[model samples]
Target: MSSNRLKILHWSDYACPFCVIGDKRLNEVLEECNIKDRVDFEMKAYQLDKDAPKKPHLKMEEVFAKKFGISIEGARDRVDRIAGIGRNEGLDIKFATVQFTNTFDAHRLTKYIASQGKDVEKFIDLTFKAYFSDNLNIADRNLLIDIAEKAGIDKKDASKILKGKEFSDEVRKDEEEASDKGIRSIPHYIVNGKYVISSSEKSEMKFVLEQVLKDEAEGKLNINE
Candidate 1:
């Protein structure tokens, strides 16, 4: 059966804790509205730290401190605050253990997984867990393959993609599109290609979706005007 549904495009990065929370909150709203299948959701790649080293250049706490010009103890407190927020969302984030590295490969892997028609949302969720909870290095090809396999992607195909440049263009395309959209931060969401929500607030996400869904049903939503 053919139907009209709101299409939601999401841009996020694996290293972004806020993106994780934002995605989770969006899912919560979708479930609450009983519209999970009514919304066409696509996850796009966004690298929070494109210039980050392939290996951990410094501890995540130290990186935070240096970037924000704060003390190491202050960085730890900031991380703990985010982790506490994640815990409220049922995610246990081990920010202290996270190996801060470039997430380009991780984004490429997600593109490849989507190409295979697998559960990209599940794959993305697992990728966030792999980094924030398990503290796995998302830049590692072997780790990506293992994570993909766990997400039900074929091991052989995952291995091939990880070993080569497959889906690299798709990753770049997502990043370029994000740039064009003026997305300066992670967890940016565009609903029905019109409505833009740039926060991780569950209530705000719920309100946006509810309004969009109503407007969509009434034939009143138009983005091309």
Candidate 2:
């Protein structure tokens, strides 16, 4: 049978703690709405820092301080606030100690996972945990292969894909699409390709998603428009 499941395109990067928290909140709200099974989600690659080092260059606190021109102490305060949100969601995310490395390869891996007709949700969550909670170098091929293995991807296939340049174009394509849409932030979401739910509106996510689902069921969304 054919189903018109609510299609959600999410743009985010593993480097982002907000993406981690926002994703958790979204899922919780979806479950509350009882529409999780009726939704199809696709996570799009959106690099928070394309120029971030392939190796761990700086701790997230250092990056935070530099970006906002604040002291290390102040940076700790800011990132800790975000981390608290994750804790509330039962995610062990420590943003201050996050391994700030390039996430391009991680994004590529997600594209590869999707190509196999698999749901990338669990895989993406693991990547975030690896980068944030475990403080692992997501750019390291070896670490990524292990993460892939845990996500049910064959180790040999993961190694081959990471070793070569597989899914590079798809990663870049997602970035280009975000640019075309004038997106200037991580954790951007497009529902049914018409309704946009950015991080700023997270507090009302349940109500917003409920409306979207109701509209979708009523054939009111005309998503093609």
Candidate 3:
């Protein structure tokens, strides 16, 4: 007699707009499945630009153009395409105003909040909203504390966690584990420790979750579908 719960591991970066869209779509799949209590969800750390400066000195447009060798207008058009997709999912991605900074500290704070048995998704949502929608700096300590408080995390506890390296190791561990799995992209989802899905399309994610549940209920032990 064993418990039949789906364990989902998601690796993402805060600076990646695609990860933001993917998170929202994944949530929709979970909600529609009506198995909130039957699933175990975990967000892991994977920095898209681990070497990024703590405080970025360039605008997002310039950063994009320089990184991809495109004109500023071309960068805007490219990001606008992703922003259009986000709008379809009821998200506001203000790419022009977003401050792209290192997300290592943010990941550490999220790890600490999740360890307290709190709803880590709430904090993750706040992080995305603060960065993508409000264009707030996610690396700011004060801002992180405020977001934590809004997510039901104690302000004092959050402040303390930010002041020290309490969850730094946990964040690093997640990155290392993901690297061991040969994961090279963000928003990667692993279901039941076997099935792997890379796309963030809402319909695809919903179909996979439903399929996993159906397979488990049918006593299928080797779930590769």
User: How many pairs collide in each candidate, listed in order?
Assistant: 0, 0, 0
Query: What digit string (tens of lDDT, one per residue) describes model 2 on residues 104-183?
Result: 98989899888886656778878888888888889998988888887788989889999999899999999999999999
Order of models, best TM-score first: 2, 1, 3
RMSD, one per candidate, in order: 2.3, 2.2, 2.8
Deviation from truth (RMSD, Å), model 3: 2.8
Per-model CA lDDT versus the true structure: 0.85, 0.84, 0.85
> What TM-score quantifies how close candidate 2 is to the native fold?
0.92
Model 3, 4-118: lDDT tens digits are 6678889998898889888778877777877666677789999888887777677788888988999999998887888888898888998877888889889999998888888
lDDT of 3 at 14: 89
**lDDT score, residue 78, model 3?**
83
Q: What is the lDDT of candidate 3?
A: 0.85
Local error of candidate 2 at residue 217 (angstroms): 4.6
Scored by lDDT, model 1 comes in at: 0.85
Q: Ten-residue segment with the worst summed lDDT in candidate 1?
A: 1-10
